[model samples]
Target: MSMPQPERLHLDSDAATGYPNSPLPVLVYRQVLDISNAEERADAFESMFKRHGWPPAWRYHLYDFDHFHSTAHEALGIFRGQARARLGGPNGQELMLYPGDVLVLPAGVGHASLEADDDFCMVGAYPPDQKPEIERGDPAQLAAAKARVAAVALPEDSPAGGSLAELWREDS
Candidate 1:
């Protein structure tokens, strides 16, 4: 089955708290995976992410506190259960994520899980050669994080099997 085009969400930088929310819009792909056999969904997501240059790094529920990664973009594939997450920061949008959904967050975009089902699980991945560093909404760390986020190289491929440049380029 062909994948659906992603829904993009553009967020602004939080001036007061210094959350350097990315200029690149967050991409959400709904029901992209076949979750009929829930047991194999993790493997499927892992394989897809690995094949597209985003190496699967972890399997767990999202953190309940707000945070962002300054050094790397991230891909989260929801393989089991469901969640209500806040994206962008304290003043960000609330989105409900279900199994088979994929969320692509650019570096510096804040995200946190507000609530989730008991069985909620997601597979997280990062771009090739990029390591994710957790950064809370600290004003002191904002400047350094912004610098690192700006210097992060864009990935050529997205975990969802398309040209990341085309989808993520600011000019796109």
Candidate 2:
């Protein structure tokens, strides 16, 4: 089954926080999978993403401290419980993510987990051939991170199973 287009959330770079937020908007697809079993839900997400050229990388909850990836974009498929997270940076927007919600974060956008239930979990993935590097909002690394973020190539497909360029290229 095909999913609907995602909701886009745009964020700006924060000079003070040294967060080199991306020009590309974060893509949020809500309730894409309604499977009641967490393991099955995660497997479904991984299979879909792998079929679309995004390889499943890990399974975990979001980090408590704000951080970003500079080398590759990220896809987080929530399979269990719920959490409220800060996106963009420390002073950025807060969003509640529930089971079956898929969050796509472009390179350089900051994100952090504010709070979550004990069972909260997600499947993290990256585009084919793109490796992720974690970046804390450090002043000394801002310039390098910005350069890396800009140089990172766009993915050929969305983890949710569509042409990522169609959604991500318009603004890029």
lDDT for each residue of candidate 1 in 22-63, tens digit (9 for 90 to 100): 889999999988768766998999999999999999999999
The reply for model 2, stretches above 4 Å from the true place, is: 170-172
lDDT of 2 by residue, 33-145 (tens): 98999999999999988888888999999999999999999999999999999998887999999999999999999999999999999999998778888788987778988
Looking at model 2, the pairs that clash are none
Q: Model-by-model lDDT, in order?
A: 0.91, 0.91
Q: What is the lDDT of residue 4 in candidate 2?
A: 84
TM-score of 1: 0.96
**Model 1 local distance difference test score:** 0.91
